[model samples]
Target chain A: EAGVTQSPTHLIKTRGQQATLRCSPISGHTSVYWYQQALGLGLQFLLWYDEGEERNRGNFPPRFSGRQFPNYSSELNVNALELEDSALYLCASSLAFGTNLPDTQYFGPGTRLTVL
Target chain B: SQKIEQNSEALNIQEGKTATLTCNYTNYSPAYLQWYRQDPGRGPVFLLLIRENEKEKRKERLKVTFDTTLKQSLFHITASQPADSATYLCALVRPGGKLTFGQGTILTVHP
Candidate 1:
């Protein structure tokens, strides 16, 4: 089966601009997760969507938002981007909850977002 | 608040030796722990997953030990090779599937 896939390998945006990154999860997966990895930093969870509903979010501000489509693909939107918003945005997917098994997330290559 | 920490410094070791990485966490009781390997400019690949009840799990040359009492997990790569060089990350999974990750440790194996 194909793994998770991301689009626009890289994105360039200026301060005050908006950026959209997309991801398609593996087949049969229903949970999509978004994470941001800043330069020299670890992956920080941004949002979690399962079954097309926002389940949970991280400490990030509201400007970091995303949604999951019926097909379980997801799109991350960064509004009013700042210079610090430049980082690698990653998307992952896993089996939905209550599967009675561990939900091991498979990640996409990620989109490199650069805000000038 | 939950916090996961890994050695930020890069680890260098000769090939054919065992490479051990550490991950320590606090303020959360995770249902399970996972390890991932990430190459530069690439996404992380799942390496292993150890549940809280599992003390040790192994896959080929990779071994992972989870100590819930100490709130720590140790990842080991035996007979390491240059190809094993990458950043290894440890993530703690909450009950609802939220994963909190550590800073990751960079490992370099000399051939």
Candidate 2:
């Protein structure tokens, strides 16, 4: 089966500009999560979407937001991008929530966002 | 606040040896813990998951041990090979569906 896929392998944007990243979950998966990994840093949670609803989000600012579509695809929008916003944005997908079994998340290669 | 920590330094070991990595957490009671492998410029791939009730889990050459009392997890690779070289990440899944990840431990196996 194909794993989660993300578009725009690399993106370059200037300060104060906006950037959009997209992710398509694996087939039959319903939950999509967004994370940011800065250079020499760990994965920082950004947002979680399930069944077209925003279930949770991380400590990021309001300028960082995203939405999940009906087909379970997701889009992450970063507004007013700053130099600190440069990082690899990762997307992961898992089975529907509330299941008895543990939900193992599968991730995509990620989009490298470079903010100048 | 919740915090997860993994060894920031990279580990170097010769092939055919055992590689052990550690993950520690603070201020969080997770229901399940998971390990993932990630190479440079690539996303993480799930490896193993151990629940609070289970003390240990194994898959092929990989073994994971979870200690609830200490709030830590240990991942081991037996007879490690150069192919095992990568950043191993530990993640904690809370009561809800949220998952928090550690900084990751970089393991380099030499021949």
Candidate 3:
């Protein structure tokens, strides 16, 4: 089966601009998660979407937001991007939450966002 | 505040040896702990998951041990190979499904 896929392997945006990153989850998966990995840093949770609803979010600012579509794909939008926003944006998908089994997330290769 | 810590930033070992990595958390009671492998410029791949009720789990040459009382997890690879070189991340998942990750430990198995 095809794993989660993300678009635009690399993206470059100037400061104060808006950037949009897209992700398509694996087939039959309904939960999509977004994370940011800064240079030399750990992965930081960004957003969680399940069944077209925003279930949770991390400590990121409001400028960082995203939405999940009916088909279970997701888009992450960064408004007025800053140099600090330059990082690798990763997307992951898993089976619907609250199941009897563990919800193990499968990740896409990720988009490298470079904010100048 | 919830915090997760890996044992080190990097580990180097000769091939065919056993490599052990550690993950510890503070101020959090996770229902499950997971390990993932991430290579440079790629997303993390799921490795193993151990629940609080389970003390240990193994898959092939990989083994994971979870200690709830100490709030720690240990990941081990026996007879390691150069292919095992990568950053290993540990994540904690709460009962509600919120996951918090730690800074990964980069393992280098030299041939």
Candidate 4:
């Protein structure tokens, strides 16, 4: 089966610009998650979307937001990008929770975002 | 605030040896701990998951041990090969399905 898929393998944006990253979950998966991995850092949770609802978010600022579509795809929008915003943004998908689905999350090849 | 930590330094070991990595957390009671393998430019791939009530889990040559009382987990690879070289990440699953990760530990198995 195809794993999670993300678009725009690489993106470059300048300060104050807006960047949009997209992710398509694996077939039959309903939960999508976004994470940011800054250089030399770990994966920081960004947002969680399940069943077209925003379930939880990390400590990131409001400028970082995203939404899930009816087809279970997700989009992460980073506004007012700063140099610190440069990182590899990862997307993961799993079967919706509480449906007796195992908790293993399959990740997609991340998008490398370079903010200048 | 909750924090997760993994050894930032890269681990070097000869092939056929066992490689062990550590993950520790503070101020968090996770339902389960997960391990993932990541290449230099790729997203992490799921490796293993151990629940809080479980003490150990193993898959093929990979083994994971969880100590809830000590708030720590250990991942082990036996008879390691050079192909196993990569960054190994440990993640803590929060109550509501969020995963908090630690900076990964890079493992280098030299032939």
* Candidates ranked, most accurate by lDDT first: 3, 2, 4, 1
True contacts kept of each: 0.64, 0.64, 0.61, 0.68
- Stretches off by above 4 angstroms in model 2 are A99-102
Candidate number with the higher TM-score (2 or 3): 3
Candidate 3 chain A least-lDDT 10 residues: A96-105
Best-matching candidate per lDDT? 3
Docking class of 4: medium
Cα TM-score per model? 0.97, 0.97, 0.98, 0.96
Residue by residue across A5-33, what tens digits does model 4's lDDT show?
99999999999999999999999999999
Model 4 pairs in collision: none
Report the C-alpha lDDT of model 1 over A11-43, residue by residue, as the tens digit: 998999999999999999998999999999999
Clashes of each: 0, 0, 0, 0
Off by more than 4 A, model 3? A99-102
Evaluate every candidate with DockQ and list the scores.
Answer: 0.66, 0.64, 0.64, 0.62
Q: What is the lDDT of residue A9 in candidate 1?
A: 97
lDDT of 2 by residue, B1-111 (tens): 778988666899999999999999998678899999999999999999999899999999999999989988999999999999999999999866778999898999999
- In the order shown, what is each candidate's alpha-carbon RMSD? 1.3, 1.4, 1.2, 1.6
Candidate 4 per-residue lDDT over residues B1-111, each given as its tens digit = 778988656899999999999999999678889999999999999999999899999999999999988899999999999999999999888677778888899999999
Candidate 1 has a DockQ of 0.66
Best-performing candidate as measured by DockQ: 1
